[model samples]
Target chain A: MQVATFLAYLVAAVLFITGIRRLRKPGTARSGNTIAAFGMVIALVATFLVVEVDAAWVWLLIGVGILLGGVLGAASAQMVPMTAMPQMVAAFNGVGGGCIALVALSEFYQGAAETWVAVISGLLTVVIGSVSFAGSIVAFTKLQELAFTGSVVFPLQQVLNALIFVGILLLSANVLADGAIVEAVGAPFLSPLVSLYILFAASLVLGVLFVIPIGGADMPIVISLLNAFTGLAAAASGFVLGNYALLIGGTLVGASGTILTRLMSGALGRPLGKIIFAGITATATQKGDQQEDREVHDASPGEVGEYLSEEANKIVIVPGYGLAVAQAQGPMHDLMETLESRGKEVLFGIHPVAGRMPGHMNVLLTEAGVPYDKLYDLEDINPEFDDTDAAIIVGANDVVNPAANDPEQDTPISGMPILEVEKAKRVIFVKRSLSPGFAGVDNPLFYDTEKTMMLFSDAKQGLQEVVEAVKSA
Target chain B: MEQLLVQLAIFIIAAFLGFELISRVPNLLHTPLMSATNAIHGIVLVGAIIVFATADDTFTIVVGFIAIVLGAMNVIGGFWVTNRMLGMFRPPVKRVRKRKG
Candidate 1:
């Protein structure tokens, strides 16, 4: 029976690895997901059969628990729209953290061996799991609009978090040292169970503090970081329980989530340390030395169509959060098709940090049935923008801002990489107003008089007008 | 000590494996991959199940039940949502061309 359980976990791990590899491309992502889910089913069935249970009530409770949970998860997954995916993912991840935290609690209470291994594992699991659970809730709330999406500040937020961090460490050490090493710590001033509860509460508060100060723009990284935390916690619980499946699965999650977090932080051109510790909110102070207002050239949709229609020239489309907000993907696709039909080469220039979350624009474009080949990532498309005849901007503000290129003014997004649309021969901008984007910084490209033109309209309306104007011209 | 060391070896290898596997995925699929990994980590439900099946007293039963429920939610919700998100990424169905049928 022990051999069978270990073999099953090994098989499951192989499946998970293959599944991840298959998810690398658009063609195999769905199949990869199926493979991973199949592995999960195998792991689940194996767990149920091997885990010794004497009580029938426990079985009943498990059935009811699983049935209830499965229904809720399925309903929400089916119903949540594409735009709300980030928060939905966050909420589910939060539940996973909460689940492991409770498992750790049960292990601690059971007091199997009370060995140093068990004690340390339980303490680590409880702390990390609680932190992830609470932090994920904050992420979900912010992304889902249950709370404000901007950074929340108080006096010495970082200092407060640090103090709590120290307290959690002290409590954790007490759990380890007093329980095993020291015979009696001053006549047992604090009970182990009560001290654990206190530690749990403290970690929960720490999780909230950890996420609350970070804003919506950094949510993808935050979510990835929390997912990694939950994974590490789950792995720690595995140590307490001595379960191979938990150990392997949890470690896989921890490592992948961390890599993705690092990738996303690099895409944002911000250090991971600054994002987490400094809490670089959208409200960061901007130096006044670089403020300049130039004459704005507002163009018409008719003019945009006419420009796009100009004889067989290449054009690049840059989509951002505004495109998602305006629901302009379908129209954007229509425009792409229209330009393609006219023998003009149209390529999509996708910035890594274009939308609210990682791959936010790609998902929208894919949903709209945009071909995978036409999409070019930042590195590939940035150079091509210089050779293109026209660059069309729809609703995105900061991702396409040339201000990122300017060295003079130290704006919040100063060092971040941006879509070099300003390099295109003619720039057609579409927007409702001259409002700053999520970064809360004005785009220098807009105020430029050289070749940039703004349509000054809603995204969907602007795109539709351009399509109409193109058809007529 | 030996047992813990074995578990540590298993953990280190798994982490390295995860890092290697996740790096292969493209930026375009990051969100879907994120959701999918979210589902994969739902393996914690297995841990919850262990807690539930072996629960002895009232405290164990109560905490174990909560673990099962939350774990089940993560497993079910994470996989369901991931599949749903991935569903949006599929290619449009193409009509087969008739060969003089």
Candidate 2:
């Protein structure tokens, strides 16, 4: 039995490593997921071998958890638009934290109530889990556009939080010291309860403080950080449970989450500390105020198609959340193919946070089988926009907004990085309506007369029409 | 043997369901799901710590302590790495082009 448990844990660890590796590239991600899942199944089987429980009840619990999780997960996946993916991530993180806390609670109940170590572990689990759960929920709400995402500040907020944090640490220290003495005296309950209560309060406050200062722009990093936190908490719980597989699995998750968070922060060009404390709102006005120019080029779809066919020597396609919303990846791919066949130089410019989630645009494009080489990150592609004959901006708003350039805009997105679509000789925009982006500000780029045309339609439909127009032409 | 088979079946089914759910979700949800799973592992940590601190056997206690340290390291290290990764996306300061007189 011991050997079997070890083997199962080893297998699970291997699978996890492979899954993480596969996740780095688009082509093998699904296979990696399957492999990891298989390993988890092995780990679960191995866990049952060590921990004997009522067979009927364990089965029932597993069934119920699966059924509930499946139903909820499926419903959310189907109902959520691609734009709300960040929010969904937050909600999922919260759920994970809640589950960990619950598991810790159960473990505590099973242990000797007087055991200080168990009590400390339980306290840690509950505090971290609760904060992650609540904080993630807030993040989800913000990303979903269902709640106010701006920083909520009261005077001395930081000071108050600091005090609470210190208090909790002090309480933890006292409990640890007292627990050792109490165990010697055979009186463990008193110290542990006090520690648990203090830890819980401190964690809750910490969660709020952690999230309150983060604006919507930093959500991707926040989600990644929370993910790491949850992984660590899981590893901690694994220690408490004395489960080798859990420890390995949890450690892998925690490590990966941290790596992803760093990658996300790097993508935003912000330090982690600045992101956590900057508290800047994501107002759309960052693009300098919309210059009053009614001289916007009003090209019909047919006219735009003609211009695209005639003058575009090198065309760059910039996709946004609008593309995902319209499910237009297939049509976009077809359009790219048509352009390529016609000897037009075509490539895609991908903003890190272009779509609802980080790398969403890349994922959607990859699914459509766009060549990896054709996709370029912002830094590599920004300079090429100037020389390109035409730049097609699809379903993207704030990323292309000129307000990022205007110093006086005073908007939260001011000084933030953006794609220089305005520099392109000819600019074409595909959008459903003039609805503002996450920053809720109108784009002045839409009104630019310098060869800018708005192809107002659903992204998928718009791309499909363009494909047909190109074919006929 | 029958009980083991039953448990295995249950485990497989649960894992399959989890996989299916994960597949349908957008990329953004992946991190959150991972976070939630990590939290569940925290419970496992608490359990091990309790067993280690209270168990009469010296071997069990020693093993538990080692596991606890490793687990704590994993959590702390993971968060630190995540913080570093998120620093990647800060917008670069635009260089002012100096005009030659």
Q: Per-prediction DockQ, in order?
A: 0.69, 0.06
lDDT, residue B17, model 1? 87
What is the lDDT, from 0 to 100, of the residue B35 in candidate 1?
A: 82
Worst 10 residues of 2 chain B by lDDT: B88-97
Give the top-scoring candidate (TM-score). 1
Error of 2 at A9 (Å): 1.0
lDDT of 2 at A467: 78
- State every prediction's TM-score relative to the real structure: 0.94, 0.72
lDDT of 1 by residue, B1-101 (tens): 88889999999999888888766456688887888888888999998998878777899888888887888888888888777767777553332213334
Give the Cα lDDT of each candidate.
Answer: 0.83, 0.62
Candidate 1 segments whose C-alpha is farther than 4 A from its true place: A178-188, A279-284, A287-293, B91-101
lDDT for each residue of candidate 2 in A1-473, tens digit (9 for 90 to 100):
38887787777777766755554544454455455556655665676566554346444444444444545544554455444555665665666666565456444444432455545655677767768877887788777667756656666776777787786766665565764544554545456545555566677778867787677767778877887677666665655555556566666666666656666666655568777765332223344354453555766667667777887889999998778777888889899989888989998988877775566566567657676557788888899998998899888888888876788666555666788988889899988876767666567788777668988888888888887777777
For model 2, the interface Cα RMSD in angstroms equals 13.3
